[model samples]
Target: MLNKDCHHNCNQGNCPFAQDSNNANRYVCLKCGVEREINRYPSGFGSIVMLLLSLFIASQLLINWEKQDNQPQSEPAISSLR
Candidate 1:
């Protein structure tokens, strides 16, 4: 499946044979004339989810920081001598 219009052994993402599933059995690349199998990019959903979770935590921290900054500081009250 990665054998579409390839001439050289280009291992870039633009390589046509990167996502060829049925070719998993094949050791040769049809596109770039290489004996190596084309590399494929994996799904990104996991990384995206992690990124969103981190962003949410960071925003919560920022909000808390702002609240603390806006609150007035109070001094300790003096106790009367016994």
Candidate 2:
């Protein structure tokens, strides 16, 4: 039999899995009784590769902008009237 408070709501504000279990066990948050696992942050070489790729894209965009800014505009040629 579940406790009066053990009527696991699992609602948005009341996450049953996040609460203390019968055996005093800690569980992850749940959405509508469904258990949710905590997501771990990226580490190791994957993070490094992502950082390098982002930097390369940013640098390329910056270089393109600089080139466009430095480009010179041509003036229209005027003809002399006889």
Candidate 3:
């Protein structure tokens, strides 16, 4: 069974984990341990994905802005006399 005191941000007023720790029990805190493990070795995929997503958004905005700014020039001011 998991120690209630070891839960992430445990706030139970009567958690045994806190009492156990206070009594000098050295059992590891699984919640904090798992978080540390994940932080210590997060996957590279997320970073790559975020970078690509931002670049794609910027490119799309640029394309839209360019289209808006590139209005065609008006026809020649003078045409052959009818």
> Can you give the TM-score per candidate against the true fold?
0.42, 0.38, 0.37
On residues 1-82, what C-alpha lDDT tens digit does candidate 3 reach at each position?
3344554563443322322343332333434432112234345877998999999999999999999889786787886897
Quote model 3's TM-score. 0.37
Better of 2 and 3 by TM-score: 2
For each candidate in turn, give its C-alpha RMSD to the true structure in angstroms.
Answer: 10.8, 9.5, 9.7
Worst 10 residues of 1 by lDDT: 34-43
* Model 1, position 27: C-alpha lDDT score: 55
In model 1, which runs have C-alpha deviations exceeding 4 angstroms?
Answer: 1-42
Candidate 3 clash pair list:
none
Better of 1 and 2 by lDDT: 1
Per-residue lDDT of model 1, residues 1-82, tens digit only: 3445665555464444343466663354455754544344334866798899999999999999999999999989999999
Weakest 10 consecutive residues of candidate 3 by summed lDDT: 32-41
Tens-digit per-residue lDDT, 4-74, candidate 2 = 44445643356546654643333555544444433344356678999999999999999999999999978
